[model samples]
Target: MSFPDEILIAGSGPAGLTTALSLHEAGFKVRVFEAVPEIKPLGVGLNLLPHAVRELDELGLLAPLAAAGVACHELAYFTKRGERIWGEPRGLAAGYQWPQISLYRGALQFTLLNAVKTRIGADRLHLGRQLTGFDATPGHGVRARFLNRATGHEETADGRLLIACDGIHSAARKIFYPTEGPPRWNGAVMWRGVAECDPVLDGHTMIMAGHTRVKFVCYPISSQATRPGAQQLNFIAELRYDTTELSEREDWSRAGNLADFLPQFESFRFPWLDAPAMIRAAPAVWVYPMVDRDPLPRWTHGPVTLLGDAAHAMYPIGSNGASQGILDARVLTGCLRHHRADPEAGLTRYDAIRRPATTQIILSNRQQGPEACMQLVEDRAPNGFQKLDDVVSRAELDAIAAKYKQLAGFAIQELNTRPSLASPTA
Candidate 1:
């Protein structure tokens, strides 16, 4: 049997849209299916590290992203008492060719969606189509079925390959791993919100305060949120609950009440920023469990494969979840271009390379990744220290940060020197 001309992609989020764009640039026809009836700018903020930014830059999206987001200049770690644990320049400030962008997740999604519609054509993107099941045809291609949420009708689409970018609760992944359940919660709950507030530290700095038990992370995601002097700050307040049982259903859009989690940060005020005040000032908050799926031994079965969260869902540490997914899109496009004669060989190669690479990152995030510095200081000097180095040496802090960057494939020197993931024509 000969290979089909087009590839079918499930989920029109970052990973799926990116794969569509990358594959199109590589001279392949692609179609994207999204479950939602309509797409909107509805998600909270997320950071696009330099590595991910580079890929977007190659796709000609850097200008629009910079307009919608703030370029992060530095990342800092602090104790509960406001003492600085570690600080380092990031993105272009750290000498990378690209800038680290902090932006609304929804904004980024819409940007990619528009690009897909314009370049891949609007007819190729099918919304309101929820992936139901898929089957690999022996010596042929794959057949994927989707349910129209609005009509309750089922439809089938065939392509040379099926790529699942449907997020953590992927229907395709569930079909492959029938015994595996929902994402595993690690007993920590996070309340995320965005508010217009005075910038903390430098206007471009991202900060992580406190430790594993109670933590607050804040960064300026958009300069357009308010006037020139103020910016829109995105924040997450996380606390470990005693119970192991999952209480609420896992949904990113789930609304959170301040009454439940605000008390935990009542005494979390510092000179640089008032944690409680920021929480109170925010118009809305979203609550979600800090959850991740156990890494699977394989992400490919014949001509079908997984990408992004569908492949490896890890703790949201080091800001690498979306970044890794972007990386996967590029690598998978490269594989398909190289092994066009035997598309199955390309899927196999993509699985071989990314599965292990992302597995190590999943394990590293469990150990706290770059955020480990905060935990070290909390363990050594819970009472607050006059000197940071006395609690945790600079060398120890530096090593932790560097190791995570390396694991996430964004070490400063290496990322700057790496070859472009774009095709020669791109």
Candidate 2:
């Protein structure tokens, strides 16, 4: 079998960009097609877990990310009334080799984009080129068709392998499952925003409040705002609602009405932080129905494969959305490096390693995400915590949280002891 010289990657989000950079470093010439005319900072916040941070650090992106992102130290939970329930250490405090990061989604994406442009060269990335369809020959290679998002002109390109990193509404994914619909909405609507506010817990914290009926997760993303006493805080408020109307928006940056959401959170005034006031101050809010797709039996079809949300669009409850995508990049690059002579075997290997791992996370997010720990406390303390030990033992709670870390591949113990995947020397 002969190996093709170039690889084509569709999408330039964290997963796609990371894949491009890794392949470029492994001596593969790679090109990335992004649907947007320009890749700007678009999303609100991202929680880079320790496992993802270690990968970024090895890629030499930690310093720039640290400069722009907030190093989260702790995550705490409290009741709507204002009683503390559970708190846990994060990053180095939790004993991981790398620190946990919380930053604007745009900042992280831009940082990765800049690194890609520098190492892979600007010419390699084609912005505004939207993927429309593709053709693949088992041993020959894969050819992808794309439309210029800006000029509406169509073009075709060929490469050794084509990866669909085009995100949740992936054209490639739909081609694989033409009869399938949009992402499955889980009967919950979400309103997310980043607002300027005074510091809350620890002045450097990530907090999740409320229950399944109505919930709010808030955390600081950046602390050095020009305005005094103001920090850039990112939040997501979730409520029980039907998602039939949510599949209408084609764009993530779409606007949602406050009147439709504020009622549930209106009286959620914690002594530590006033949820309603913080939400009301947000200049813009992005509303979407919380959703996930059932894991596909496969992500590879001949020379074509999937990455990120295209493969597994899980709920954001566990903060693993971006982290899992970054993980996919690492595993995919590893397989390509090890099986250079056999691209089919490489794709199969990539699926074997990542598909099951990400599927576990997707299902975990649905059932026992980070917020589940808080739910246990809420169930025990129906009347609020007068005696914290009565509801659940601290040791027991710690064990539950630790189990999640282990499953998500971010337990401090695993990071300190686990062996690294073979780095591509190609």
Candidate 3:
């Protein structure tokens, strides 16, 4: 069994596409498969953290991304009562070499898709090819089977490696661990929607609101919409609930009724933004359990492996869900580039570096994610705080915030001081 230079990637989302583009740039022949008949703009907002930005920057994509996205400068935490709890600089303002971006998920995906097409050619992407199964060929490559969505006919493809970026509920992951069960819900049901609203706060600030029982967060994803003063703002309404049922673990397009959970936000009227009005005016709403799997011990099996959500789907609490996936693509590409002589060694190295890093984030997101600052302030003053200083000291809040930055592996100082991934071991 000999390793080939070509790889077959399962999934057309950010992780798979990014991996394909990067690997192509590294001199690897890449092919990508998507389960959908046609790729449509699904899902809502996602943040492009600095770490991810660095990867895109290296790929010469920063300008195109900046043209299509909004650069966020700060993230603010406030109580439902409209009191500012904590605020920190974001993106380049936070001293990172790269800036942070917030945009519609579809816009980002399309941007990456376009880039991949430009670099690797449109023929590289195969739509309507749902990855069904795969097997390692003795010691070196993977033979993958797929069900064509349009023809309903079977197809087979072979490559030196198979990557499952198929996302959460990944068919590739299921093939590996069939009995692992559905993604474990974190006891928090979240409803998301985009609102056409005027600038809130600094307009670029991402805000976290409410407490554990009735927490909500919103931020402006775009400033230029059809009407003036109407920005495309994204909001997420989360509440604690039992998650034993696995009936609603559908894809991102699952529709949610406003009445199902609007009662909690009925009274949530803040001076900066009217919560109920925004929710009501939204033309579309998506609902999903704020859930993630406990980190896996490893993501590699022979020539087949996992990447992105298929690898480590974590709570979106820290705004690292998509960014982490992009990071995985970059690191995996780095490994593959360095060890092309033995591609299997590259897969093993990718696992060694990223599995532990992402595993730490998965567990941290469950325990004390970036939202911990808001949680601490809310817990101290449930009703209302007479004074911000009395409710929680600035030092305490800063420490909590800094800890999350470190854990998420994007602390500006740490990244600057540490050696790059190319320098043997980082």
Candidate 4:
């Protein structure tokens, strides 16, 4: 088969947009198809680890991203009783060349979308095109079929390569893994919201309290909440319920009621911050099950492949989901650059390099990832702790943190020394 010219990208989320940007920068023609008719600043906050931030920096997006979100300074873990379990400097504070960022998921998407349009041109992006299916033409490229959600029209486009970044419910993924059902639920439900509140700690610290069964995570996503001494805080209150089955649809925008989970944190007031107050002050709360899919043995088939959540959906335990997807975009682009003469070879190399790397993260997240520190403290000292060392040693905590960083491909020294994933020409 002969190498074709343009690449077809499905979904306009972070993964797809980043992939489009990277390929376009490498002097490749690319087009992105998004299911949403229009992009909006929707969804809550997300973290971009230092490694992921490095990729964004190479794309010349660091300035806009820093403007949209807070550069996190520290990550601390605490118990339900409001006692600190572990604390460590993060991002630049941790000596990384890049800083870890906390920003709204929608803001990140829109930023990437704008970058794509500015670089690749607006005509290359096809909105309201919901991917229904795709086919690989024998001696030609892949033919992707889409349903125009706006006009009820069917459309078909052909590309040399088809990259699926359509997210968890990706139609392309379904076609590949036909037997796979809905995402596997881990019996936990998460209620997320953002509130304008006084800065807790340093105003740039990310905190995770409680254990696996019941937990609370809070951090500021933006600096827009300038009410004298207040900042915009994004938070998630998660609880593992009795039923293992997912009762409601897995929608990110599903409305949630405070009455259901408020009692659990009724007495969770602390000197620095009030968990209950933050939860109540939010304009709205969205509920979603903490779910992920079993890592697939393969992510490539001929010239078609998957990326981001479509390829590897892991629990949001360690803030690695979006970061991993960003890394996917970078590595895949580099592979394509190396194997441009043979698109199939590029797809295969991308799969070989990313599949195993993300599979480990998927399994690690299932074991709670770095959040294991919180659970360990909870298990060792269910009531409370006089001194953290008395319950768990410093060495144990250090080991947990180090292992996770290494597994997530963000070990401080390693990340600093690693070469950029950008194509040589780029």
Candidate 5:
């Protein structure tokens, strides 16, 4: 028999799926609504920091992540001409109990989705349902409306709480901040793609080359054996424009024109990898304007609140786009479990813990976060440095990295010892 306390989840992406899984583990009923008719592996590569990996490990997904993705060994920064500026051990190499992972964004989403379906039942996830509006009746909980895309009819579902994990264009968020316009652009556009290629440095390294304006990010996401010794390489080509206006809204499926950004990166040839050859190898490319919303003063309004991108959408810098969303899911779940008697209090507490944290990330990413080193190198030694120390010291580089890890809640020492976020231990 279904109870009146069932949780209603809007959006079935990683955060939403994870939310349902966590709630189910704590003996709460959850139903997820998604706008997409079919959930397929979409989007390019993303990295999971140790903090985010810890949450997934709690959900019993560490093994699957390793099977489908690469356990990143190191991360490095370089000049546009490919001169190394800074490099450091990453994931387990950096001494965290959890390993940082690099994988296709779709892979991680499905990992969480599959877990939810098996544990919460496939029927719990309602596809083609777009969240339109929601009414939260203080103590009684929420009654939400949705547009059933397949049938083209409005439907309603009542639940004890509503969590909106919808993406940046979240319908629920729009309702709360109707005066807010489209996502704010940062004058940069990214062309992302994955290709089969030989390993660059260690077969498991993530590298960011170039500076803030024009940059190239590449890493081996998986070793799925494309050829005799080839692995799938994920790369992003970013360029800053004088104008901040994005004619087309961001879409992961939008195909990019080769002539648009290839020439800018063709000259990035290095002994470790050929620049032009790798770009030409990809089957297709997707484009997105670097955009994010100003952090809202609040995320919870009675029994209805937001999570993931709907709550905090930061720039891709610092590899926290999806990682932070994963953290939000776990933290929010822990809060809800602690305040089971008063679910409204749970929503308020979650907003207090997560909103301020992600707000800092949003502002830091605008300044390039730890990636500021790339821009600094470009400023001081644009002509290429004979010695990287002359451009920036190891102490300066380490401090920048440490500060970001602390802010992002993944400093090696802290993350290794931080207590588990999932309640009932999955």
Candidate 6:
């Protein structure tokens, strides 16, 4: 009738790996299972907002993260016609205690992976094991089953609780909601590519050009991806289609044809960055439907729960997806530590706090989150405008950005003054 002092986790993505580090720091045993036999720098770039960065800082990873990627100095928006609509300082520039780190998703993943290996011990990671199912007995905790992908053999792992961070197509999510269906597609296709190019805007700026239906997001993830003067820029070109059929495959690793979405952004040329030219120069491109699952009413079920894309797979708007998962790791670990005497209650508490928070974000991203400003300008001035403030008022822009930051839990003042989710108990 006591806590087992051990935890089992599935999927070593940012969420699971961060959970390992957080829980281990809180003095618990954690074993992480990853589906891939080897974890490499696979995906393209992403941003870790100031709030998420703060959590990593608590874990003493700020130095390494700063070393890995660029700390974005600004987030600027533009119309499809290539005129600046709204621009604001970001990270430390905006006064947040932590800077928003823009690095390749793989770089961030390996950052978490390396910390886990060093802090949690390399032996604790079981690669090539995919979660098949799990059974949680009333008093015996949870016994989870996984397929050893390398050997094609079944293996079982037992722990006081199980956390699933296996990503959008999560196996743990399937076991819970067998009828949930695939991630809801917004009928928009996203073509993502990373190219080493001359710096666009400022080398440290993240820019979103265009509006709701058609948009281009670009930023430099690493200056080190290439030689001096050229930076590694990750870009996503998105276009909405009026079709219900998901004709193209939806895998994140699916290769995409440049001919498809590149033509739409042919006019995305500005004095600073030429969108079409950048796309053509890219060595590779990946396409996937812009998709997210509807928020679940619950994430924790007894001793089992979900994290990251498993719990809330949201559209990547306002640069908040990975940041939310990192927040989840800190809160989940903090809750369990607070409720050490009743760990199951901790799962419920973590669910209560994070689920509602992420649900709001998922719904907001559907409506374009803070990026709605671009759509507003596109609607009013489709032909482009001479003066930026004439299209959208400064007050309106401020409101949009403020609302999202507040909802996303990174409002400058609030986040700067908020207490750490990493409990001081440990």
TM-score of 6: 0.97
Model 6's number of clashes is: 0
State the displacement of the C-alpha of residue 38, model 2, in Å, after optimal TM-score superposition: 1.5
Better of 3 and 4 by TM-score: 4
lDDT by residue for model 5 (283-312), tens = 998888899999999999998999999999
Candidate 2: minimum summed lDDT over ten consecutive residues — where?
Answer: 417-426
| Model 4: residues with Cα > 4 Å off, grouped in runs | 1-4, 424-426
- Count residue pairs with overlapping backbones in model 5: 0
lDDT of 3 by residue, 1-426 (tens): 555568999999989998988888878899999999888988899999988888888788899888777788999888878788999999988998888999899988998999988999999899999999987874678889999988999998889899999999899889888889888876787899998887778788888888776888888887778897778999998888755566766557788889888998877788786788888878989888877887888788878889999999888988999999888888888888787777777888899999999998999888848778777877888898888999888898898888888888898987656654432222
RMSD of each: 1.7, 2.1, 1.8, 1.6, 1.9, 1.7
Model 4 over residues 321-369: C-alpha lDDT tens digits? 8999999998998888888777678888889989999999999999999
Query: What are the clash counts of all predictions, listed in order?
Result: 0, 0, 0, 0, 0, 0
What would the per-residue lDDT of candidate 2 be over residues 32-114, giving only the tens digit for each residue?
Answer: 99998888899898899988888888788999998888888998876656567678888877888888899999999999999
Give each model's whole-structure lDDT: 0.90, 0.84, 0.85, 0.91, 0.89, 0.90
Instruction: Give residue 408's lDDT in candidate 6 (0 to 100).
Output: 93
Residue 158 deviation, candidate 5, in Å? 0.2
For model 3, what is the error of residue 5's alpha carbon versus the real structure, in angstroms, after optimal superposition?
2.3
Residue 174, candidate 5: C-alpha displacement in angstroms: 0.5
lDDT of 1 by residue, 272-293 (tens): 8898999998999999899999
Which candidate, 1 or 3, has the higher lDDT?
1
